[model samples]
Target: MRSVYMQSLAYVDANRIYSRIMELGEIGRTKQSGVQRLALSKEDKEAQILVTKWMEEAGLTVSHDHFGNLIGRKEGEKPHLPIVMIGSHIDSVRNGGKFDGIIGVLGGIEIAQFIYSNNISHAHTLEVIAFCEEEGSQFNDGLFGSRGMVGKATEEDFQKKNDQQVTRFDALKNFGSEIDPARYKESVRKEEEIKIYLEMHIEQGPYLDVNSHPVGIVNGIAGLSWYTIMIEGTPGHAGTVPMNLRNDPMIGAAKVIQEINEICSSQPDQQTVGTVGIIQAFPGGSNIIPNAVQFSLDLRDINLTRKNRIFAEIEERLQAICQENGLSYTIKTNIELDPVACSEEIIDVFTSIGKKLDMDIPIMVSGAGHDAMLMSEITDIGMIFVRCKKGISHQPEESATKEDIAMGTEIMLQAVLQYI
Candidate 1:
């Protein structure tokens, strides 16, 4: 342990890691000065190559899986030891910030560099992976890479195409690689293979930055449910449609949206949130009474019971509104993802390291989902939270200071030492 600590102190240069992140930030900037490296795009593939180069320079054995996730492994004395995995996604939403996902990947690489330089030997290996996609901005699929690795993805999901009509399998081929039809199941990491997993990411919200806390120890990830609500009614000329004589789906939709918001507001707060992200009207013209309206509802909560209750309330309210208005409607839940809790054992290690470093690490729940959520299913998982400037993400303006990132990186290194 003394040797490991000395190894970390000797080779871990926070500023160097910071420079690398800033440099990568320049390579993938969008025209708007945001980021645009969505899943399988030319930019995304190029970033993979760049990081793989760094992996080689760090002296780790590097390879990519059938899912396109890049893994860099540092072998320990015992080759068959269970690995301590650390990584996050490299893909971003349109105009996303730099630190959202890449921080974990880079931090892990830095740790591996330190281990190699100090000749630190351990029973467990350190594995750093760059998840292919976490943001579903370009493709309709999110966590595609992680899901494929864990064998959670179905054949139908692989068949689903992106905006370019490129299937997930074909998208990999476009990058000069092909998915083995038989090896899809081999992608999942068995429970015995991974001892633990840790990820470092920007808070992506204002809590830590506003509170003047330098870091956050995440407690659990929120569960989410999404549904598309379609309302059907008779379309008629606006001038001819009498107020009382017409069956108006638009009117019902408005009432339902209002009720949905109010119901969510009325619930006991446990980090529960609801949103209506998309709304569309058929024949959306000023002069025509809308005959059809489709909208999407997203409900999320850290506590599973609260999420289910809110979801049920919205469904009941929508049904009542449609029946009362005599309008035909349909509600389809596109996805209902379960919540994930972090490993208490791993969380304790993070907290202990933060104390030794004299960092004020607050405990918080991640409102947004992440690759860590998927990794948690197979391993004991932990996360390090760097403070974002304004607690904002998924935009060109999303920012985090260099100092905050450096602080998180050092803390992460300490945690790696303890884990190994």
Candidate 2:
């Protein structure tokens, strides 16, 4: 293929990128055409091997850090300059769509391939990374790989046990990785060694597609918190207990759920969102009143203070409801992630390139968490989002057209060139 330049960078091969995406999707192929390559699973290992091979074929040197982050590096004219890093994770949730994290990793490879094939020389070295586990589907600890790289991961973090009683340390050892808790800090890259970080991902929401835009330049990632609530009450026979006399926990739980919705809806900030996704009632039968109910609550906002304030309101209302319903409750927090803003300098690069390419690119906030969120701690970070069909993700139906993927890749390549 003849070299096509956008300013000074060569246009990425759309066909080559799409083909590699399909190839990676086939590794953990589910019956429904989804993926199940949970982190450190056999399938995840296979996918890593394949990606490593592709990186080598693209004329990049491949290496793995103590934290299991796979890195591929290409030397630049000035090896002393800080490296320009690009990448995303490859691990998938159970039966998740193929495009969630695959696009960014493969897209980075495509850029390296373009550079190598065209003999383009850059000033700073380039590194493409395939993060180990960003979905947290396995250990329920999201951003595990990037967390290690930024020196945010603790020994306690690795001690967490999954549902099967498998600790993260054991899982890594089982997956053929060498583990030394003492060396985790050594894996962290110094702030001065990284010039910038960029990741290209699917929007995972319908905003861009609905607005008829092909690209989304991310402005920030939302902060999120998860809680498990349990309500306890007395159980009685359905036939024997009168409706007015019975102490039903489910009733209190229902009231709490409704109040949660109200609090979130009444928030002046439109970016705040609340969800109650999981519910379980004890004595779940036609002839008994439920004595206990357990449910999960997810709260998110781009503003950390606003999100915490909303959560406080939820707790206050929930306490009142429990007292009125004669039920006792307990709440436990599972996860807490702070909001992160994207670098304005990198955002300008994307915006400038979008205008030159004649594409309508809008600056937007991301409601989802990514490796880029954790990477923000160590260096300047930016993101490019492609349109996904129906804005659906984490399921079998998650999708992005080849044309949109190609567009995102081109924008990412151009941004890298400009930055380098």
Candidate 3:
């Protein structure tokens, strides 16, 4: 293999990679320019088809797993060697930006194209992947595909329903990627030789954009906990129920969410943040007092001890509110994700690659979750970040410059060259 020009790699048909990103983003574009390709949605399946076609055109063997993850393998000099994987989720949140997860997977594809043209061959296999269902937009099941890969998903998970329109099993079946019952008990990492897992994504925050950096190396990811709360109360006519007499769950819920924010806010420098994303009452009409209210709370922090402390404070606050309001409440933690630290070895390699290419790069932590977090539990993981215009994500305004994408791809190309 010839030596990479490093900086010149950014100019190698850079427009082509950007064009491909735009093309793929258009497949699931909603009315607001936000992407709508929720996991296993028809849009997601279509995007898979399109990328698979491109992978085949790139002369890579492509296939889908039981979890619907699209894997495109570019065989290296040694077919049996451990694989070097680079990718991110293909599914997007509702009204999400085009470049968030797409950049990573598409960037991997672009890297494969660059390697092919350069005739670079490694002793190990290289795979460009598009992980399915990372967002949990369609069904509140985050990192479904990666969870399956790590053998975390159970048989009961298949029975979970999404708004009565889709079941996990049904969605997989629709995509022709259904998992057998027996496979549920099988291991995801059949081979213990995975060298490293790499992901390239937009910073999804203002750090890189504000700092004027084109590329970033991720050091860690924040811990996350999602919980659902339900408060039950007696129903009554709005006008007839006195404020003190009424067991209004809505009032209690409002107080709880407010207190949750206040508690987490008391932490140092806002290390903890909580959001009650969804809230609704049983008697949603204006004429009646709400008998019950259901809501969800998402809490996140970089430290696990602080995360737990915040959660405890939230629970205590909610219990007090319900007690004072004379209402019954139930809480269930839907998911708990521990903070993940990237491998120092992988981080050094990425940093060295950036310096070798004279790219301005800095170390950072991800505020959002990615499949990389899960992959870290199984093997050494590394991440590259391209800057978004305003550090905005999960919205239509999210934007990344072509130069940033090209630079990230160049860094990844160098890393892959050394890693594989």
Candidate scoring better on TM-score of 1 and 3: 3
Error of 3 at 145 (Å): 0.7
Query: What is the TM-score (0 to 1) of candidate 2?
Result: 0.91
Regions of candidate 2 where Cα sits further than 4 Å from its true position: 1-10, 178-182, 234-247, 280-292
Q: What is candidate 2's lDDT per residue for 34-137, written digit by digit as tens?
A: 99999888899999899999999888999877677889999988999998999899999999989998999999999998888878778889999999789888
| Candidate 3: stretches off by over 4 Å | 1-12, 177-187
Computed on alpha carbons, the lDDT of every model, listed in order, comes to: 0.80, 0.88, 0.82
TM-score for each candidate, following the candidate numbering? 0.92, 0.91, 0.95
Backbone collisions counted per model = 3, 0, 1
Query: Residue 66 of model 2: what lDDT?
Result: 69
Clashing pairs in 1: 35-95, 205-391, 206-391
- Please say which candidate is ahead in lDDT: 1 or 3: 3
Give lDDT for model 3: 0.82
Ranking of all candidate structures by their TM-score, best first? 3, 1, 2
Error of 3 at 181 (Å): 6.6
Which lDDT tens digits does candidate 3 get at residues 233-294? 88999888788798989889989988987898888776677888889889698888888999
Winner on lDDT (1 vs 2): 2
